[model samples]
Target: MLQIKDLQARVEDKEILKGINLEIKPGEVHAIMGPNGSGKSTLASVLAGHPGFEVTGGQVLFEGQDLLDLKPEERAREGLFLAFQYPVEIPGVSNMTFLKTALEEIRAHNGLPAFSAKEFMKLLREKQDLVEFNTSLVNRSVNEGFSGGEKKRNEILQLAMLNPKLAILDETDSGLDIDALRIVAGGVNKLRSSENAFLVITHYQRLLDYIVPDVVHILSGGKIIKSGPKELALELEEKGYDWLREVETTE
Candidate 1:
């Protein structure tokens, strides 16, 4: 559903991603694990068309369209969703209002009509049940006063509601307790389908146990050094990144 070729991205004058190449098929989940400052999160940011990052080279194709050509909102309109590791709080925007606006925009882009408040709430409740998202937060400002778990769950709640074709979750496991992690994983698993794909960026192998990956890629020094099944994650967790790097250097 998504393919990136020789992806190179920079923040300001400092380049972060160097020649990243990955392809994700629908119904597949790919976990990207890397040491700190290895450009893992940069890849996610670049894919989502974040304005702060510049594409120095390469192309990203979302179902055949050049993703770099689209604006961030346009990327979202084209069925790309990126759940940020750090969700920003919009003090003036109510959670329900923010979601409704996004839903309407996406619906329009997809040639669907806007939802009435009742219809929107009905859809929201259904999605909430799917993700087990709490209803109390819906009326509050987006991300305002949300606990770490709540922020992550709200992100997944949006995912469940939008039903994007491809979802890029950058560091979804960060700051989450075991219970929260399971809840987040459950929400993501519920959304998995033949027409959707997931790019899960994480540091620990524990998250992999909850959301099994079709492929595990070890990214280090800005490139993928090892690619294998879920067993690769276990190997890394057991042996540490130092061993993985040593093995990569030998290869």
Candidate 2:
């Protein structure tokens, strides 16, 4: 569903991703793990069209359409959802109102009439069940005073509501307790289907245990140096990234 070719990027003037190429097909779950400062987050930011990062070269295609040419909101309206590592808080907006407005925006983009208040609330109720969301959160301002776990839960709530064709989760496991991680992973597993794709970015193997991936890729120095099945994650956890470091040294 997504294809990235020779993707290179930078922030200010420092280059990050260098000639990175990766493809994710519909119905597949792929994980990206890398050391710090290896451009993992840079790739995500570039793909989402974050203005701070510049794509000096390469192209990203979502189902054959040029993705970088589209604005961030346009990408979302087209079924691209990215769960940020740190969720943003909007103090003046009620969560329910914000979600309703976002839904209307996406609907308008899709050539559908805006939902009535009752209709919007109905959809909210359904997706809340999908993510086990509490009514208290819906009543509060978006992400305001939410704990780390709560913030992660709120992201899943968006996933359930948005139903993006490609969900790029950047470090969803960070700062989550075991229980919170399981809850979040369960929500992700529930959302997976034959028609959607997942690009899971994580640091450790623990999250992979809950939401098993079809494939696991080791990203090093801004590029994927190894790709394998689920067992690769297990190996990485057992051996550490040192073995791969050794391989790189020898090569």
Candidate 3:
């Protein structure tokens, strides 16, 4: 569903992603684990077309289209979703309104008709139940006054609503308690299907315990130094990233 080739990106002239090459197919879940400043989040932002980060080289194709050529909103309309590590609060914009507008725009882009008020409410309720999202926060401003878990759940709620082809979750486990983590992961598992793929970026292996990935990649210094099965996460958890230095040195 997504193809990234030698992707390099920089923020304000300081390069973050050197050359990230990853291919995610439908029905597969890929986890990217790396230490701090390893360009994990930078890869996500670059894929989402964040204006703050400029692509220095390489190409990204989303389902055969030139993903890098599209704007951020265009990327979203094209079924690419990025859940931020830190979900910013948008004051004065109710979560319901924000979601409705976004969903309408995406559906229109896909040549689908907009949902009627009654249909939208039904979908909202169903997705809320699917993700166990807090209904009380629906009427409030997006992420405003929400706890960390609430914000993460809000992100999953958006994921459930949009039903994107490829969802890039940038550290969704950050700041989440065990219960919240389970809830968020459960929502993701439920949303999984043969038509969609997930790129899960995380630091700890605990999140992988809940959302089992088809492949686990060790990213260091903006490059993927190793790729293995799910057991790689267990080994990384036991041995830590230091052992990978030898692997990189050998390379």
lDDT of each: 0.91, 0.89, 0.95
Candidate 2 per-residue C-alpha lDDT over 164-211 given as tens digits, one digit per residue, 9 for 90 to 100: 899999999999999889889999999999999999998899999999
Compose the digit string of candidate 3's lDDT tens values, residues 1-251: 88899988899979888898899999999999999999999999988988899999999999999999999999999999999999999999999999999999999999999999999999999999977887899999999999999999999999999999999999999999999999999999999999999999999999999999999999999899999999999999999889889889998
Any runs in candidate 2 off by more than 4 Å, and if so which?
A: none
lDDT for each residue of candidate 1 in 1-251, tens digit (9 for 90 to 100): 78889888889999788888889998999999988998888888888887899889988899999999999999999999999999999998999989999999999999998988899989899988865678889989999999999999999999988889999999999999999999999889989999999999999999999999999998987788889999999999999888976877798
Worst 10 residues of 2 by lDDT: 242-251
Q: Each prediction's TM-score against the native?
A: 0.98, 0.97, 0.99
RMSD to the true structure for each prediction, in A, is 1.0, 1.2, 0.7
Q: Best candidate per lDDT, number?
A: 3
TM-score for candidate 2, residues paired by index: 0.97
Winning model by TM-score:
3
Q: What number of backbone clashes does candidate 1 have, counting pairs of residues 3 or more apart or in separate chains? A: 0
Off by over 4 Å in 1: none
